[model samples]
Target: MNAPPEDDLSLGQPNVPATYFKDQRVTCEKDLYKSLPPLINGKAGYQSLLPDHTLVDTSNHADPNSEKGAKIRPDLGHYEHGVVSEEHPTMLDLIILAYEVKKARKEDIVNDTMKCTKPLPHDDCQAPYENTCQTSTITRGQLANYATQICRRQHRTHFYMVFIFHPFIRFIRWDRAGAIVTKRINYVEDCTPLVRFLYLFGRLDRAGKGFDPTVQPASQAEAEEAKKYLKRWEPKLERTVFKMDVPAANGKMRQFLVWGSLADPESPLGRTTRGYPAVEVIDGVVSAKPVFLKEQWRSVAVRPEVETLKELNEHGVLHVPTLLCGGDLPGQETKTHEISIGNWRVGHKRIDKRIHTRFVVAEVGQPLENFPSSKVMLGAIYNAFQGHDQAYNKCKIWHRDISGGNILILDNNKGLLSDWDLAREEADLDNGARAHERTGTWPFMSVGLLQQPNKQHTTRDDLESFFWVILYYGLHYLPHTHRDSLDHMMKEIFDQYDFAERDGMARGGNNKDALVRRGRYLGSRRSQQFSFIGCQPLTEFLFDCLDLLGKWDFRYDPTIQSWEEDGYIPASHAEMEPLWRQALQSPLWPVADRAVDQVRLSKRLDFIVRGERPERKGSKRSDPHDSIQDDEDDDDECSPRKRRKTCHGSEAAHL
Candidate 1:
């Protein structure tokens, strides 16, 4: 450890003058609060070092009010000075660090997690080692949970965690790229390292403190200006207003005022897409018309959404959200990928590096599920399909992530395909690269892609995703008859996954694959199908669409392939192209443009679709077909949905 604060030697910490930590005696995890608070609060060094902050121990915190899972309480937190309340529980702004403590030594706690990113032999995957020590596994999970909770509660670029084991301390810095853990420091003999770290943490500015600088409080006037055109969502707190600066169409920095409460996902990781209906601030004047503003984190290697949107606009792709402006937020990217603690380098299979990104679209539309009538929903979906087709055929852009959330309905009820962050150009991605990273939303991702984790994303996968999006909204609103078994069906097909022993990732494609393989997309009886529903036209349209393309979902068993005698053809854009055509000529249209019944949607979403989310939905049995299944590529008889090369694995975190 470094010398005590009185060492008077210049040490390379963030802040200049060195401050000392109290020599508080502690034995185990329980004693950390009692012994350490003095170093942060009044008596020890709190006032002199971090006058504006206080360390609050909330290890047992429970928020009964939050419907969004148990508020994961960090053992201790460095927060802006104040008493913690249910409303401002974790201090959403100005967070210094989140701390977790394990009674065990640093080795026991840290070694619990496997270095999946290490350059290890493919056959010798480290995943099985995670089960070697049960306690260490639990501790690793807890540490990741704490880090994730902190990231969710606060809008931040990255955050820090102080993992303590009495004498030993490890500093973990977390970003979208993953985590960078420092070697352990023994703080029992000399407390300077912990003291100096905390002192400098308080000294750093807002960004240095890990808050997102792109977000700032909106003025009362700006908030009022945005409220006129923007719709609102009820957030945990009385909605806070904020203004974000993004690159405008004119190549100038412009401000957009967001009135609605920016919603955080249940898990504060991944794209964490924060979207809003915003109005522009131009020359001290707010625009009368509103636009859509979306902010999300995306891989640096992935093509920018703006470039794809501009490409679509240039090729005159139909039904796509019109690109106005916006690009990668300069100088705002993850810092964790650069950090590798010897054995743990960042993995390239998932996200290598992520950058904060912002963009605006001219159309301010409602979500796809909010369609007033069945025909409108069909039209919107049909329009989105056309947009996808033109983008693929004309511009050679593949929109990888197709979900109910990504489709929107305009005032005229035409569907607009949005959320192109994961879209890629065919030229740039001949193999549909980053299969693990930018693959679309979970429920809607093609079963083929989900089944074969390393599968290169293909147009066929996108087409399958399109079908799921339609079925998702259809099952929710079209009044399907499979009531008693709806919950089980949804859970199995959409949520079920088996941990691929090959890569150690949850790949839930068996049921979805079985759904197609058995021709059981719908049930057997009339009572099992969506018959005599209010949205009969929509139901009919869906069946027609499914029959045309879903037939191609046949399992491609290469062992029994015919050399032209069977006349088998792999799935292609030709089969899916008809859905868009049928949608255009679709005689049935909704009686009127209608908004979604939020209450109804919410209830069914939890019940039928998510199966009310059990303590854990009973896992589907592992498939004997662990071999990379194929969907049969037209040109190259490759594995399902054109599998990408095997994974180093991807995503938020596995631990």
Candidate 2:
């Protein structure tokens, strides 16, 4: 927690109020805020927010999976804390975008890594990229960390940042696409731009401040109704009691009193998804049945989740999450791409469009690990397989991202396939207008997909992913016979991902690929791979999976480009169906867990996405949370956490 006696930008009590600091010798960060004049509200047609002193502290809001917890603090933050807006019909607690500031010397912070010539060349900079500057690299990571924290707290289109390197100050705008940074402006020469920006920012309303206008604060009565449903929100997250208004063309508006989401993204970009426990409120009365509310920024290149769910539900697909209401947030497209930073070539190379989308489903359930017995686990997985097969064959919608996170267990112990946000329709895929894109959780992704970065998702891949999801669940919860270190064993067996230097793309599954192709479980220390204690049915079921699909020998033969080009088609859903069903009717039921551990199942999904073992005390490896590092790099460009910063962005010295 931050030590208080803090002053906010909107309203602060500075001891020495100085309007401009040009020639002043301000050495400390505290002095810079203590003496600077704030942008007091109602000054220029409504300059409400002011500048004050408060370190950008995010001690409480750690990634739930993180063991040591998130320990990050920027030099300063210009924010509105919490403002309740009564201007609209529904009282709204708008999603506020906080501006970050970092104190640094001229040598550390930069806009680009390469040196510019006197007369800029038409092609790339002739000088070698100054990529080895450690201070500059760490500063960029720090900025990313701050942006990630803010985005987790609120839904935003894009947010701004103030990067100061003493005499030189740079303005940066970050979004899902990437960051747009302005060239260095020597604040020592003139402070007008900085002052004008702060003053102008104060005059803007909630929407102008980058907060979602449609998300309003829930009234006292609505809050009470929500408490009856959800037990309690994440202690790390601020309890969000709010209303979501999804606009409809037929004059019918949708509203839900959302309590909290499943998990928050660790990074500022990508599909920042949250599964909310929500209840409908029509004509001021809360509905009896609670619903599952999903909010995410869908890539404009892909189809919307609402369309996929609606089509599947209409087609009578079984075991899929039932769709209720879903749509795109009106006029809520990402604005980072539209921004132009002259002379800075930051955000153009791969600027993918992202749209804010919301959808509601009638049913909600626990995750896969919540199952009490092996019987329930097998039954659930088999039924979920049924849903996947049905969707692929009947509705022609393939479940591309088949991870443990997407598998849900209903009140009746039946399995349901969730999170079709990444699903691709067969018709659309066959059309050939769209390019094949890689998607799925790393730990649970198919070996073939992981091995070949350019390969497209196939039903055979989904079947393998489903099997991996089951295996991952079993290893963590069920009793196992691997007598070695569990953490080390997991790290080696999962064979999650590691970045390749040539292209900066993630690669894994070499071990897993060898396992299936050669029929040997490859572990570094022990040859005795897996032996489930007291569960022969489960063990037999897993071993049988080796024979389910014939090996395609996806070895890269530099000669013929790719295996797909070599005319090798993936196995259909039907080919893997018989094995899944037979496992369900195994002679021995799925064994019940010997002892329930204290660890939660939801964090395990994070394990899959992070792709790194959860390092802790007594482990051979150094703990990751010891410093602020971006080990997260996704193959989809906007992949989940565990990356290296490689987006198309230029860096220049602020000085």
Candidate 3:
């Protein structure tokens, strides 16, 4: 099938300097703080009229004579003593008052004054009025939020007794009365995975009261065998956790389910479902047997991946998960054969289990959903392209499916290209030109493939996909307009258009509505939108690629408005390698240099979207980290040009 017209392309001088990247360290703790908003001080702004109709400082009420304290003291008879009078006071009020005082002080110690008081106040003298905070019932959400805030500031040490006095203090009474509610956290829940992992391994608080002894190997021989075999084959194997119980034969074999990851020398497949790390009970002794668990898939697509992985491993590409072992299941064509005791499936399988494939590899690190920096994202793209180069040139294998989810970013700050189930040998392309079925993830698929009917897929299209990935990341990561009229049109085109429609003569295939259509056109249109007007560097970078790809083929001239007749010079990986490398080194959009952290980049981009200059010292270009500062000159109108062209139609139609 003939390819569709190329995207309108314009070549602009590269904006970012090559070889200017600088690395900066980032940790999970810093990222978490940046991502979530800090807790508000419970009493800082909490103000309401006292019983006597006087405004008081509920937050900073440390001194009795202070404005808020002066209001709170007269009721407790502290007007004379500056402390709770021994004569008369309600027990609940005293308890709550003491807690509030302690809260105002931000102290951890439970003052003795908060304990039970004697001689209840006479009915005539008692006010029986509740404090402002205690007048309402505190919901679990409020408590959790306040608790989280306290822990965030204090490093998870203390849980202040924030007594909300509205509607009366009834938490103690409600509990004593056996009222059922969502379980309350008495202390801040420590949910850090590493902390829990260490606790499981007896690395912290080794009391061994309820700890399972089977977490580690039972015998020294088993331990040595595990250490020796894993060291020789998968030296990166670090922490292992016992998962489940496995059925054994005649009570002779002790079987358990386990999963682990690479330790020192990191690998990409950090977390995966391979097989259980078990200590097999043999003839009265336990032995370690780390057998690979391979699943069965209907398509022979996995064969190429298995072969490619083996070849890559041999060449010392250890960042990618190295395959341990693989084989087809026996007895049922594609059905797995019974191997040993610790070889059962852990999770639920589909109705047709035969379509599934299970393979084992040296576990790498966990997958990261978000990137730390645009430089890091570019670094990942760079690494992926290098892998593609090696796979195509050295191994003669072409990865057909390159999507965001397939390429994993590991903890080692490295990107690992994976999930090659749709890959085919390069020889397949050389043999003959044939109409191949449409394949690839929708979001990052090549523009030519989207508009064109059945065509021979090539490595050039895959590289084009990498460009789309970069653009997609910037748009997705950088904040944009919330209620812009342009956004509505853009969303409508992406959400309502059909990307994979086929005509009756051309393969009469099933056509369905999709979230997006005309990938190249959509990208081009967005590049020109007012939302992207200020981000010319990034937009121009993408446009330049379209220009280059179009030029690679003699059939199309993106620079000219006219179409050319027949002769085709299909783009090759070798021809586009330099362009791709240049794009990687080029400067990104505002505040996108590696030196600027993700948090700052997000804020600056948000400001740019609002048609405002990025504020403060961080926006200055002098320091790469502080670059992209707002300029008085950049506060241009936020409307798109009147005749802006779009994917389905011009923006003027919507206007």
User: TM-score-based ranking, best first?
Assistant: 2, 1, 3
lDDT of model 3 at position 562: 36
Q: TM-score of model 3 relative to the true fold? A: 0.40
Q: Lowest summed-lDDT stretch of 10 residues in model 3?
A: 624-633
TM for every model, in the order presented, reads 0.78, 0.78, 0.40
lDDT of 3 by residue, 82-123 (tens): 223334231111221111211121221111122122222212
Give the Å error, residue 447, model 3.
2.9
All candidates: CA RMSD (Å): 8.3, 9.7, 25.5
The regions of model 1 sitting more than 4 angstroms off are 1-30, 45-47, 59-67, 82-90, 103-108, 112-132, 234-236, 249-251, 259-269, 341-351, 431-438, 508-510, 513-517, 521-536, 550-655
Candidate 3 runs further than 4 Å off = 1-304, 315-320, 329-356, 363-368, 429-435, 479-540, 552-569, 583-655
Please name the candidate that would achieve the greatest lDDT relative to the true structure: 1
**Tens digits of per-residue lDDT for model 2, 530-580:** 766777777767766655533334433346556577764446676667766
- Residue 192 error for model 2, in Å? 0.8
Compared with the true structure, all predictions reach lDDT values of: 0.61, 0.60, 0.35
- The digit string of per-residue lDDT tens for model 1 on 1-655 reads 1233555433443332232323455566777767667656656423535667777776766433332343566777777766566454554343477777776573345443445444422222344433336776777778776665556545678788888876678887777656666656777666677767776666678787677787887888877776665543323334556788897767667788875323333233455456666788876588878777877676666677888889899988999888788988878887655553334542323335678888888986665656777677777887888888889889888888777766778878788888787676786666645444426566777877786666677778888877777776666555556544555666676667666576555576677666555547574223244442455555665666566554564434555455245544456677766656665565655466354433344556666766785234111111110112121111111122221111111110000
